[model samples]
Target: ESAEEVIGELRPLLKGILREDKKSIPDMNEDEKIMHGCLESKPKHIDSITRAIQMTPGKALSVLLSLELKGLVRQSDGKHFSLH
Candidate 1:
């Protein structure tokens, strides 16, 4: 499956893991919390995902590229990504 698909599949898993491990989700904004929850469960660090979560759409794309290069995530067939 593509990265986006992977992320979509993994998102809930990540959230579940975080909720289980941390006892509570990070007190971030909705977008930030979603992104943090996603990354916190990954095997590797994902700065791009964090940046994307924090910045505008244009910057988020840049962050996505960076995250891809870092091998923390993979790009989907479209505008999506999955953790590696």
Candidate 2:
């Protein structure tokens, strides 16, 4: 599937999950909440994934690399990632 398609699929899933988690537990920072949600869901193209959860480009790239190493995602291109 295309990168955009992958991103489209992940977006709502991430949002829904994050929203539910936020309602259940409070006091998490946006990035921490997003990172936790993403890790749990194993979404694709997460480096480029932006929403209520935002990060610096460098931090986002680092998270992507870490996820790749953990086998949750695969590097599809220099600029894209896919759930594995």
Query: Which prediction has the highest TM-score against the true structure?
Result: 2
Of candidate 1, the 10-residue stretch with the lowest lDDT total is 24-33
> Candidate 2 — which residues are off by over 4 angstroms?
1-47
**lDDT on C-alpha atoms for all candidate structures:** 0.56, 0.59
User: Which pairs clash in model 2?
Assistant: none
Backbone atom clashes (below 3 Å) for every candidate: 0, 0
Weakest 10 consecutive residues, lDDT, candidate 2?
23-32
- In Å, residue 23's CA in model 2 sits off its true spot by 28
lDDT of residue 10 for candidate 2: 100
Compose the digit string of candidate 2's lDDT tens values, residues 1-84.
999999999999999889887833334445544654654333345444643257776776676666556555566545555555
Error of 2 at 33 (Å): 6.9
Cα-based RMSD of candidate 1: 17.0
Q: What TM-score does candidate 1 get on C-alpha atoms?
A: 0.38
Residue 55 deviation, candidate 2, in Å?
Answer: 0.8
